[model samples]
Target: MAQPIIEFKNFGFQYDAQAEPTLYNIDLAIQPGERVLIAGPSGSGKSTIASCINGLIPFSYPGRCTGSLTVDGVDAPNASIFELSKHVGTVLQDPDGQFIGLTVGEDIAFALENQCVAQPEMKQTVERVARLVDVENLLEQEPHALSGGQKQRVSLAGVMVDDVKVLLFDEPLANLDPAAGKQTIELIDQVQQKTGATVIIIEHRLEDVLWRSVDRIVLMGEGRILADTTPEALLAGNQLAENGIREPLYITALKYAGVSLEAEKKPAHVDTLRLTEQDKAAVRTWYQQTVARPQAPAAAPLLEVKDLCFGYSEGVTNLRDVSFTLNEGDMVSIVGRNGAGKSTLAKLICGFETPRSGSVWLNGRNLEGDTIKERAAHIGYVMQNPNQMISQSLIFDEVALGLRTAKLPEDEVERRVNEALTICGLYPFRKWPVSALSFGQKKRVTIASVLVMQPKVLILDEPTAGQDFRHYTEIMEFLRSLNQKGYTVIMVTHDMHLMLEYTSRALVFNQSRMIGDLTPAELLCDSTLVEQAALKETSLFTLAQKCGIQPPEAFVQHFIDYDREVRDKWQTV
Candidate 1:
């Protein structure tokens, strides 16, 4: 048997300023060359454990540590971060936060330079790692100027430049498009095979991570390991759902069909999971039972863009000749690969960017003449990074800022603030200090702040990025409620589940152009569109295909309809 490369024995950790420990007594072991996934909902202490493995808990976070923890045989608490860096390389959740170099090549070479390696050797190592991560062309480009997905890849290249024995990735797929996300998982597998490193991935996208086989999954909740087992055994039961973690959609579909997999010992990979004839029949029966809901005719357009063209500078256009109309009460999603101009289009709609030669109309009023603040009355834009949007120290004050700025009466401001907080599930934390909140909590603060303004059209960029499953549902349900009340909601996101489960329409962008505008089902069903837009087919679609269903697209459509029906029923109840 191989010795454990990473081990935790009765380990506990608490921040110095907190009254309670963030991590409970944890006992885990990952042998050399093993790949492990640390998964949990937001605030579940999975990140804290990753910090411990990277020697950031004691050295940087000022945390109290108890029990033994070791990484690559080095005592973690006592070892300096510099010493731990020799054995462990960490890619943080925020790639921007981890970058220090101006250019991609410089960033990747920073670690090598710290070791005082000769310039020639450093250059060679940087080039090799850049090739490994497929960022060779981005070497000379500024890291900060790159897209979110590109920045993530640069971060990976920087960490892989060093020959570390253990690699830690924190939410690596959080900002990636589905296609890029799939490629990232494949790259991780290749890196593991080539380096024989003990790789630990901390992420919430379990299905994406499950694209490649993992030795074990260390499930955490409130700082303790809930289940440390193989994916097959883990998904064989309802533990994940019970713990507020999202099970794969296919598995959920199977459960909905009343199919049991308790007797099966095979892996849960959709391609490999063999269903009995009865199971197949049950799935078909469920599909047959699903009734498609009638679509209500769309209201008149609330926001319209015509012949819109925008460029950051001469010869660099981000959006060109873009045209779209969004109707009142419509829930729409804009999706594409990173740097595909999805966000640029949102900014244009919200009056953050001036068009070169086009116009935006909101309810027959021209938005080109309106200032950003003036446009705020009709459009609220929640930025992708919560840090950029948050301004106040207290959660309540933050939410109330926009309302107060509008000179609303104090009583009205208070009422609106409280209501927005309640809707975003941040009411209990209204009085809490913003600095004390987790990333997801802070995201809710920004959302509540926008919701208080009561804009006619709400545009959110990756609204559920850092959120947990419970919060994702809560936020989406809130948006659904707003949609029912005739508010227009638009989201720019990479989450296929969100696109399919929430939005009725999708506008697909590629290279600063809208390539396809159709229902989410149509976009997903058309393989060419999915590939051209850099999106992946949903696992539910794959499940239907594996079940030998004819015209898998119809099954996918039925599932979506069924899901919406169930959600509506839950909301009414």
Candidate 2:
């Protein structure tokens, strides 16, 4: 029998200088060339399992490891991080912190340099890995200057150059736009096919990547792997959601159609579930009705944009000749390719940046005159990186910071802070030190911090970037509840999944212009517009096509309405 490339036999681990083990008895194995998607909810010990493959647990993290965890032929606990590098290559969640070079080319070469590769051979290796990760065109660019997706691709190239037998990707698509994220997944599939390396991926959005290719899916929660099965079988069960794993929208749709485990034998996964004439007809009829009629465009602008334009530098024009209006209760998504000034536009409308020209009127008040603090009375902006928004050492204090900063009464602060914590799903951990939390938990603290302020409009930048399915739903469900209470939300995101599932309207940005503003179904149907804006048509739509459904409008709209309120924010541009 062929030796397994990665094996975790009844393994458990605890960080050094810590009280309890973070992981307990994780049993997993992967043969050479197998692709496994390791996924679970926030704080599920998913990261801990991936760390063992790279020897990060016992080396950099300093932990007590039990049983056996091996990569290639060596035991992980017995090897230093450097020694394990010979057999394993790791790509971390945050691409910014892993850079070792000023330029993309240099970054990929750094690992090769450390290996003492010949100068001529190193040049060839850099070229080889660049193509492997699809960053060949970015070789001469500065690492810091690249977009979030580009930065991740460069990081992948750095690891691939080493030709390590085992490859581990930790949330590789977290910060990527839909288009880039799909391309990256395709690259992983290509790399595996060509090199036959053992690939293990940890991600929140499984359907977007690793779809039919993943050999197995491991679900974890509260420091243990609760279930291990093929992707299709795992998604077919609602039990995963109970276990803190969020099932994909398409799977949930299957459940709703009476094809669920409760009604019929769950066919392992949606891929193997098999579509029937009735299944196709039921799904098809819904699609035809939705596509035939999408609630007639809403009128009477809620927020008007009169030739609104913004820029950050002398020669660059971020938003040019942008004119549009959003009505009350409109859940709008502002989307664009990387560096198309999507974030810049969010800053302008929210008063973080003063527009160079034109006006963004919110309730008849031009946004330019208001300070971000004054705008906070109506608009709350959640920064993309939660680390930047976090200030207090403890979770409770962090959420209370806005209220405290306003010098609110003790009674008012306590009442409001607790409410926000509960809404953001951080109520139980309110007293926990902020440092003890995972990345997703840190993000929740930031959301709770902003929500306590009670703004009329909320702007979330990449809210679900690092979250798994379960937490993604928790946050969005809260936002939907808030929207029901009359909070207008405008999100700036690269996640088309979030856009489809939550927003009422889309503000498509391309070439530094507000190309078009349309409904989610309209946006997905326009292949040219989606591509121009650097987004891929969602996988649900693609899968529906495979099943021969016309347009898949119902499935597309299912996600759009999942987190919305019925009160129409009916403004279209």
Candidate 3:
């Protein structure tokens, strides 16, 4: 048998500033040419493990370490980051933040150039790695000008040029659209197969990661390794839900239909799952017997956009003839590929950009004359990047900034800010420094900052992007409650499940055009629209088809309705 390329033997680590060890007695091993997924909720210590593997924990983070860890036959804790860099190359969550050169070629060659390699050798190496990542043609383009998926590929090329033995990807799918994300996963598989490199992926999107086969899954929680097993074995159990990780939608659907998840059935991947006659019968019976609740009546229009046309440059359209009405007490999702103008639409409505020849009306009042500040009174926009919105050092101060800016009384400001923090599940950390929080927590802080403004219409851009399923549920449920209380909510997001579960209607955009306006189920069930918008069909649809359920869209909607009913009951309890 081949030796383990990476091994951790009863390892433990504690940050200098932290009171307790973040990782506890972790023992793991990864063989060469293996693909393993590390999954857990926020604060699960999975990131800490990544830091240790990359020689960042004891080096950059300055922590006390116990036990031993090795990567590529070198001791990790005692190794310099530069030494480990030769063996481990990481692609970070935000590909834009990792760019260091002006052009794609320069960025990929930066590491080699730093080593003082000859120009001729460097050029050959850069072209080879760029071709490996399928980015050879994009070498001359500015890294920032590339699309999200293209940027990610550039990031991968930048690392692959090093000829590292292990590839570490930190949440590579977080900012990508569905099609882009799928393509990224496929690219990672191809790169791994050709190079025979060990791959370690740290991600919260378990279902998406499973789109490509993985050798094993390491589930962690509370600073402990909960389970390390094959994906098939892991998905056949309750560890994911117990640890606050979201299982695949189809798995949940199967469980809902009382279909047992036998290991032999291969529940890990939808395409490979071996369904039985009894399982099909069970799903069919459940669908036939289940009664879907009637959808709520449409509310009166509270906001409207007509003939909206916009572009950053003259004669080049980013959004064209786009129009939609947002009714009072409605929750809708705007979904599409990145740069499909979803965020542009939100910006136009919020008065950040003036439409070329369009108008916005709120409550029969023309908002064309409203300034950005004036629009704030009726509309709240929470940006996707928290760093762009946060201006305070502490969480409490940040959340209260909007309220104080409005000249609310100090006592009232405190009341509203605390309430918003509670709703966002950030009240416990209200006194903490903003820099001390995780990316997900910072995202919640931004949401809380907006929630305190008490706008009539709330527009959130990827509100749940960096969050775990637990926090995602909390924020969405709070938004649902707000909708019930007459706040119209619009979410610009790439999360298909969020659209299917939390939203009643979806506006699909593609190529700067509003392509489809329909229910979430209807949008996902139509293959043409799904493909056009770069959206993937929900696994629940595939499950329905496998079970011989007629009109798969109904079954999808029925599952959503039934799931929401159960969730609502749980909330009431």
- Would you estimate the TM-scores of all the predictions? 0.94, 0.86, 0.95
Tens digits of per-residue lDDT for model 1, 318-354:
9888888888888999999888899999989888888
* Comparing 2 and 3 on lDDT, the stronger one: 3
After superposing candidate 2, which stretches have Cα over 4 Å from the reference?
A: 16-19, 236-239, 260-274, 282-302, 393-454, 540-551, 558-573
Q: Among all windows of ten consecutive residues in candidate 3, which has the lowest summed lDDT? A: 289-298
Give per-residue CA lDDT, model 2, range 267-350, as digits (tens).
Answer: 444454566667766655544443223563454455777886777788888788888887777788998788777888777777
Error of 2 at 102 (Å): 0.9
In angstroms, how far off is 471's CA in candidate 2? 1.8
* Model 2 poorest ten-residue lDDT run: 564-573
Which portions of model 1 show Cα errors greater than 4 Å? 263-267, 292-294, 394-396, 408-444, 568-573
Order of models, best TM-score first: 3, 1, 2
Question: How much lDDT does candidate 3 score?
Answer: 0.91
Highest lDDT: give the candidate number. 3
lDDT score, residue 382, model 3?
A: 85
TM-score: model 2 vs. ground truth: 0.86
TM-score of 3: 0.95
